[model samples]
Target: MSDEPLVRTVRPGVRVGVDVGSARVGVAASDPTATFAHPVRTLARDEQHGTDLTELVTLVEELAAVEVVVGLPLLLSGQEGEAARIARDYAVALAARVGTVTVRLVDERLTTVDAHRRLRDSGVPGRGQRKVVDQAAAVLILQTALDTEARSGKPPGEPVTTGGRRKKERRR
Candidate 1:
């Protein structure tokens, strides 16, 4: 919290955003200029068969993304919970499979809730939202990352190295 804002130097390239949920995985991608993010797709969580991760890895490769930003849902108290743990695991698995592309986790406290609100505000119905809420949330997550990197002159979140989860107190 400084009076002077940090000027971040962000690389210009395509970045992918992921929102990992218990039932579905949302995917989003930024433009090559790293300007805007839009929904890519939603994959059914297939932990049993590992299909979700497979598809995600393929998608990232296809997009030739420079970075992959995964949403880490932290509790309002700035603490980790089951959902956070799940996201971390997903990121670890993704990192192992994604080759050189980097995976970073950004705090996503209420992106899903906000996405729902945005969808509703945009006239998307409750029932219809179930199919795309995750994607909307992914968009918010990626846009937030892009904005953070541009404003703070730093990557938006902690990078997920093959070693494992990066930090515990991200908010502080």
Candidate 2:
């Protein structure tokens, strides 16, 4: 028999992952037990009016998500670029809107690339992959976060607590 250990749920509540792109934002949700992450839907980015954030708030309340993991697109060398800055700002705004729910930023170094490779390997043609690639990437990001949390026995990623000690941890 295989020797892989079964992954146990660390914090028993739903978690959501978000992949914010130029035009579309991909969303994913974990089960109540946080054992599996699955794609929910793609939303058009509304940076001008923040309609996307409103929808996200509704989605979070509806799913009763305990945490929201926003993908921070860090470079391979671990430097923050424009994309990372955008993600950080978005996470802050999301945290402001979500009230007591936690919003965290996890480094998303190669999630998009890995998602593309996985889709191609799974026989999903290139033409159809673009439509759903963001969602797939969100799934990868959330699954990785969940696994890390379970293994480390702590919540994964930097908690985006604006005006709090955890937010100050961003410097570290």
lDDT scores of the candidates, listed in order: 0.91, 0.89
TM-score of each: 0.90, 0.90
**Collision count for each candidate, in order:** 1, 0
Per-residue alpha-carbon lDDT of model 1 for 110-143, expressed as tens digits? 9999999999999999999999999999999999
lDDT of 2 by residue, 57-98 (tens): 999999988889999999989999999999999999999888
- For residue 163, what is the lDDT in candidate 2? 67
lDDT for model 1:
0.91
Candidate 2 achieves a global lDDT of: 0.89
Q: On a 0 to 100 scale, what is the lDDT of residue 91 in model 1?
A: 92
- Output the worst ten-in-a-row residue range by lDDT, candidate 2: 163-172
Candidate 1 segments whose C-alpha is farther than 4 A from its true place: 1-8, 164-172
